[model samples]
Target chain A: MKTLQNFLFELCGEQLPSGFERMSTGAKELLAPLVDECYTDRSGNIVGYRRAALANAKKVMVEAHLDEIGLMVTKIDDNGFLHFTNLAGFSPEILPATSVTVRGVRPLPGVVATLPPHLLSPEEQKKPLPMDKMVIDIGYSAARARELVRVGDPIVLRQSCADLLNHRVCGKALDNRAGVAVILNALNDLVKMPLPVNLYVVFSAGEEFNGFGARHAAWEIAPDEALVIDVTHGASAQTPKNKAFPLGGGVMIGVAPVLNGEVTACLLDLAARNQIPYGREAMSGRTGTNSDGIAVSRAGVPVGLASIPLRYMHSGCEVVDLADMQACSRLIGRYVMQGGAVHYE
Target chain B: MIDAIRELAGVSGVSGNERNISEYIKGQILPYVDKVYEDSLGNLVAVRRGEGSRVMLMAHMDQIGLVASFVDDKGFVRVAPVGHVDPKTTVGRPVVFENGETGVFICGSKEKKEPELKDCYVDIGAADRAEALRRVEIGQTASFLSNTFETGRKIVSGALDNRAGCYCLMETLRRVKNNSCELYAVFTVQEEVGLRGAKVSGFEIAPDVAIAVDVTLSGDHPDARETTAVLGGGAAVKICDRSAICSRGIIEDLENLAARRGIPVQRDVLASGGTDIGSVQLLGKGVQVGGVSIPVRYCHSAVEMADKNDIEAVIGLLTAYLEK
Candidate 1:
């Protein structure tokens, strides 16, 4: 668990395009010696691979989107309230009164602010907050605002991660950045296991915004099967038991119309064979990851979903356990090491 | 010959939106021109009743697409590209709206470098999506402001290549003046997409002597194709290429006319892409056809610099060679 936490921390600290240049340079260096070849796509999806010794061995793809929920600078109003558009689906209520750093040539610190309750009518105050009225106030004059920050600036949470109760680590972008770390760790393990299948560790972009990057990556890199590794909400005493999977219990492996049934069965069987703990996560349809694109691809690529359990999904502070993270990597690594053909539906 | 070329280049029109150009040809020879009308595809057709000459002079009215697609609720609109829009030129361009609402192409994310056409959209200072949809629809199109200015001697800049051909047919009608042979000059729509408009027009006209007038690449630009026929080389005679293969007999006729009348002409073969001649060649029982091309630089872009002298010579050659 200590080794797992340190590995995830190093991956999280890597200057990923989570609004940073030199993206994947550090992450690529960390995953370098393990994977035989690696490259980043135009859409910023990182691709690392492990080759099979045999010529006709099965090819497998395990994907994790590199993009996370963030803010795009839409406008800077004259009153100095910075207007923002959500890069992905985000609650305006969670945004206001939250700290965020505007990433630019020079990072600018600011706070998302909302219209004063005093200014709103009692009728308006009762209503759900509108994104339009919400703005980020960096406490600068209009001229200075124009001089300092331009539109289209990437905004990230200023909140640093913390170690929560129940052996879970909390962070600003654990929604799927934690999933990115799991793939890196899985690739790290494949270095020793020498999987019989050709394994591709993919990092998708724009999954937080639009699936444009994922759709393109699926088209360009068409693998036989795609396993999207993302973070699903974990259940707690406060969370409805049925609504979310449990935190630190085990990895949540998904089964659905989106994921191939045979492929997912192999996941469950792999977990059992390796004696790795995992929970069944029933996804109704279109698992909302790069899996969505790969499922309905040209001829449809068989897919599987392996999720890292996290609490407070889509918010600033999210939690993930290091034990589940390590178990998730091992389960996927073992599956690709011996997984076979999926029966066509 | 050049007047025909200039008429096509100088006319201002956008994709799915060519009125002035279509109307200009309508008055020139609407009487002798058979079945003159606009198609659902936005192509203008002028037919000279000829059983012998199944021909289509294909040219596009659309130069490039405008930034029309918008994102409403967030104040930006997804830009729908009307034609082959270069994303590099779009970053800070001032786009003109159909209702004259002006706005700049917003690069909403600095992390994104040189947005692809689909990645970029226009943000007209609309408060929201309802206001944006009120101004622009999902399928509206516009031009990047028609600009024709003097760059140097005989060298001119504007959207011409095919429009120049559109005008050539217009003037060619007057030049062919009283020819009894059949001719069809199709000022086509969406040629930028595929040689689509001409495909339909050629299927309709099916003349015997099918000939098209379009612009071709010139070797005049610095470090250009080594085998490029130079700028102002004369009316480009198309031998063969991807889009169309000119019949040897028709090719002989045009070259004989040029040689006999002392009209300077350059022989050309495009390495890639087929033209309307590809369509005209397969019309009906197969019309024997060729093409007269004007040498131009920077095709399919704004500032499609062309040689004015070469253009005029094409008009002269088209007018003189079209005798019945």
Candidate 2:
């Protein structure tokens, strides 16, 4: 039996940038044994299905994006350095002096150059560096660079998962990988027992860029209900109490206008009944997740969101607690066993 | 000594990344010294033990360079200084990474009244971000590239600032066989980054006296800032610099030894800049410290030039001082 930390390490290590989700074979292989039927969809989402005990039963869709924010090659300079643009929104501040791997003709190690503090002017020190001014050094000449790399090739930030003292780990791509891990763990139990509803699990693509994967998955599956699992911002010293959830605070139950009120109440009630620790997040508008797209897909499918508490959402060192992930997995597992109670035509 | 200086100056040992240079120096001095070993902070300490006064000869082996930080869209790599690099001096020079990959240092901005480091980038001929990333990585360091060559009596090279000092100490270690004092020839690390290595080694091997071998600026060029030293003005005995005031006893001893040995020596009173001696002076209840510096032109630039004869004089003076 593989440890949860090792499972997360292997899952998060896969380099699945937005448009490059077809390369999610590693994740698919991991998901293969968990579901009765697992395959990659046309829209680059890994979909797994487990039939309910009764035929033609109602379906419950569970999803987490497989893609993480990364960089893409824009232009190669005459000197053989690489210029890049972000695939999704990420803070430019975390990039300097960070290490990345350019997924080109061959995987090559690269570094983001940082101007030494000794050279900084008083005024230049005050502002963050603009992305356009940054480039990656790959130690190749222009001709050799052209031979080895091409424009639009994805660049993945490389950082090994560091195990913390508590049941916590930190590394790149934990945003939805933690959610994926929760689903994988839940599927281990869901597949063995008789599920009350047809289970449709989607490891989505482009959730960091767009909601195309979830939107398409929801339309195709057209389930009676949907559950979107992802990572929510964990509160830190810098983050406000209302803006983020705390790590080790168990699962975060999403409550918003678009999310199904009955489904939200069901999840909250189940958490209390099962004694699964959970926190409530009140969003004024869209949840800024795949839930938004899935809710309105195919003349409105009701959605419920359960997120793992994660710190440093979009950097190379996003942190997540195993306890929270297990809690999220258990909550969803119980909800699936209960047959996803509230359903509409 | 000039040949050794040329050889040593060709290698890169940028501040934190001093392993290669340390290994090179360790191999070179091992045969001549009694015992040689590297310390925790990468200082190469070659000692010839004796029952006499504990004397230390410290020289920094690290050089100033740029660390790759951000690569721009056009595959141009922006860098931060690893030490003190004047953006003006670095423009249009070639830089070599530890892997021997070369890049052309160029400034991209036109809005500069005086361009700072942010305006500069290293062009490795990468066509785009992907192409550039296939070769270079972030946090990688690069040293100024210059082949060591001699014109007339002057030798020009990059990293000559402290390599010349290292060569001077290595020669003295080789020559002073019948030494009356305990000699600790330490090729220190990170002197360009505030004399870090010397501080650790100085406290650990708290000697009776410490002498830093390094390069000092010469005022022989046009619009020179320094007035007291010149390119061929022999080994400059430090009276005072920004870092430390030379011990009076050690200064007198070095000067008298130079007179007896017929070695050319001059008094150095640099208004700015410090070396390993500064940190050594403050170590272990305060050790008596002095410096023996080779006068070099264009001190921290790529084309740093030093007089061959002055390098020899420094070697002779240190050899005589240690042998006595």
Candidate 3:
């Protein structure tokens, strides 16, 4: 017996600057064969739904954002240089000399320009150049560059996912794309089995900016419960151990006042009963993910968060453990299949 | 008021781990209110039934502290701040976990120019990771050692930034009798991290008029940031802070009430910092929000200082307003 498989999984176009529609379309094409129903909403959220076999059953949604931190061209200089501002929070120290793709009239490759040490004053050399002072050089004359690129163009870091030591990988926009991968992997497992509840999968958009996508989707779906999957800081030598989780430490479950206590407890119990490795994140307030917006949606939804540990977030070379991704997917899949319950007062 | 402040200050209630303080506040205000209950977010909401306007008075019960994130093989416990923690105040200070396990904060090394949170660790006196694990598990929160003492007329203690606020609210609950309005005295959680508990409680209660009782920065200190509020200057009627603005109507109403009652009051326009007023203001359909701030010095540190006279002024004004 095939269980209800009503899920919406939206893949945001690449980086919100270039290849956004194209990448979203690619994700749809890849996921089209897996779901019973697939569609995109006005907010550009990809939705897939698998109906439960039981006539009356609870609805559960799992969401991950698709947008990545990027830059927007603010001005074009006469010397064929482009000045841009960050679309999201970015460390200035990591911007210099990084490769970027400008989604101008056509995709153009550019490099974040840096002043040579010989030209910099001692004081200027001591600090990283501020975003306003940094420029992108695409090797074009003023007239030629103006013809191809204009102000307000979106720029994305030019990097692709690459394998690392063990079952790890690093790439650009892994802060949330890795979350999308987790949903995709979980869907694969759920599609083959009968699910206990109706599932809605959302690949939300604009989480890095305003969380508009998740907010709209949550209002429309009005699910009984939701699980927001995103990235948390991974443990690193430079980061405090308490502020970050281990790379291969499975999934990080959030404990916050904003989240539903029952849902959080259920997720933890499922992890232990299933023998899936998991860690706890003590968030005093606001999970700072799509869960925040989703929790406060129409009449308020009981929301839970399962985060994948990521290192170097918002940077081009973000790293994540594939094992953790798998574990997150398994935990979500198990929670949904076991008929997750949340009391709505 | 001083006794309540000392009592609440001596309890450990860090953000996301506020059950102990929630229970304490519930027991303290139960007899005065008609009904007392806890919301899903652990907000202790005590309601005194009345037929007049629904009014909510919020005071956050949570304080800033550290959460155990990682433990090393050598028994060093790595921690992350649950709220805005100054690393300078954390160094060489004592902390107590929820289970009463104690530890001393230490910096990683002296090599770094400016020590960041990453360069800090807590020595729990465990010989190794196994022993440390037995004492404190990951995800548990620990607050600065709770201590309250008086020097002359000034009271200094940890968690006073909010416990003082709690004390003021409790004193109001006791003295305020036969009010016309439906009074909701909410002891909220997680204000140090963000105004989270009030956000949910505000949404649920939907109070017509909401006021937060919290500590405001006192510029009376020699090295303090410039602020209009000062110690022993009486209760500060907040004009505005970073998180919220006191509605003009509420300000006028409070001023007129204070003047009529002959209770001295100070106007507070804090340069920075936030309280639960912002959350209550934005709750469903909006609420006319204001704050009664107790002037506090060295906020978020172990030894937060407040004047006894200022505490009494707050208790007097709130009791008058509620009983009016």
Candidate with best TM-score:
1
RMSD values for the candidates in order, in angstroms, are: 18.9, 24.7, 15.0
Would you list the C-alpha lDDT of every candidate in the order shown? 0.68, 0.84, 0.82
Model 3's chain B TM-score?
A: 0.97
Best by lDDT: 2
Stretches off by above 4 angstroms in model 1 are: A13-24, A114-125, A236-242, A339-345, B1-324
Q: Residues A242-263, candidate 3, lDDT per residue (tens digit)?
A: 7799999999999999999989
User: What is candidate 2's lDDT per residue for A170-206, written digit by digit as tens?
Assistant: 9999988888888888887666798889999999877
Q: What is the interface RMSD of candidate 2, in Å?
A: 30.4
Q: Sorted on DockQ, highest at the top, how do the candidates line up? A: 1, 3, 2
Give the per-residue lDDT of model 1 (tens digit) for B54-117.
4555655555557464456766777767666777755566566655666666566666655666
How high is the DockQ of candidate 2?
0.01
Q: Report the lDDT of model 3 for residue A312.
A: 89
Fnat across every predicted model, in order: 0.00, 0.00, 0.00
lDDT of 1 by residue, A53-124 (tens): 788766777888776666666567888878765555477768768888776556778998866888989998
For TM-score, candidate 1 versus 2, the one ahead is 1
DockQ of 3: 0.02
Model 2, A240: alpha-carbon shift in Å? 0.7
Model 3, C-alpha of B64: deviation from truth (Å): 0.8
